[model samples]
Target: MTTFHDLRSRRRDLLDDLGELEDAFAEVTAALDEPSNDDEDARAEQRRHRAWLERQRAGLLVVLSETERALLEFGADGWDDP
Candidate 1:
């Protein structure tokens, strides 16, 4: 019995997480392009962050689907079953 507002809030949180991860990735890219490959540890850290982002991305998809369903259900006029 989740409400529309609840689903919207959850979707917002997921989008916020995605934006934060994108910013973190920019930092990783900056570190990687330092004109030297002497930071294997940094590269490894970047890989880990990217993997985490991938998992988050997948999770966002599910949230998006849920939000879409909620919107549709709430907006469907005369959806009451006979």
Candidate 2:
């Protein structure tokens, strides 16, 4: 029995994680775009890191979507219980 409070809390946590990941992704993208003296290895590592962040972001988005759907199903006055 998932409560409204539980869903809201999970949604908030997921949103926070997604926001942080987006920030990191932006930073990595900026680093990659800059004309630095990084070697091939360093560039590869940056790419890998960006890819990993993208994957994590995707997963969080999926979960967030599900959570939103569940919340919607709970109706507008759902928070009255919690």
Candidate 3:
């Protein structure tokens, strides 16, 4: 019941979401790098946040890979069927 348009749209949306996540990760990394905020407690909090962001980024990457594989298989199956 899925069309090529649907697959493409889904892929685009996922890619956009991935981009946003990467941007956020970069911002968090930059904030962590600032030497002025040298408070130990603050640095610990930032490290925790960075870890969470890394986990989220990793999860998204896995999902994106799976989606790409699905799209490829869908195309191949469409061509091979009937």
Candidate 4:
């Protein structure tokens, strides 16, 4: 069984990781929005990267959601103000 402190730490880490992922996702999206060459291969590669990033972001979101729910159930343990 994980301690409340451990869960709090995990939640903080997950939130930080999610923020970084979101930043990266935004950058990739911006790159995709820019005009590019007509080469189908290059376009396909960019699309693949975008898709992969989207999947990563989705997975991180799910984990973050789970972590938050667990933390909520565990209570704030005086770590937070009511």
Best by TM-score: 2
| TM-score of every prediction relative to native | 0.65, 0.90, 0.77, 0.79
- Model 3 clashes, total count: 0
Q: What are the clashing pairs of model 1?
A: none
Instruction: Give the per-residue lDDT digits (tens) of candidate 2, residues 1-82.
Output: 9987899999888888999999999999999999999899999999999999999999999999999889888896753233
Ranking by lDDT: 2, 3, 4, 1
Task: Residues 1-82, candidate 4: write the lDDT tens digits.
Answer: 8776776787788778878878887887787788976588877887888788788879988987877677778775663322
Worst 10 residues of 1 by lDDT: 73-82
The Cα local distance difference test for each model comes to: 0.70, 0.91, 0.77, 0.77
Q: Write the residue-wise lDDT of candidate 3 on 1-82 in tens digits.
A: 8666566677777788888888888998999877764779888888898898889889888877876677787666553222
Task: Rate residue 31 of model 4 by lDDT.
Answer: 74
Candidate 3 clash pair list: none
Which candidate has the highest lDDT of all? 2
The list of candidate 2 runs beyond 4 A from truth reads 77-82
Model 3 accuracy (lDDT, Cα): 0.77
Runs of candidate 4 exceeding 4 Å displacement: 76-82
Sliding window of 10 residues with minimal summed lDDT for model 4: 73-82
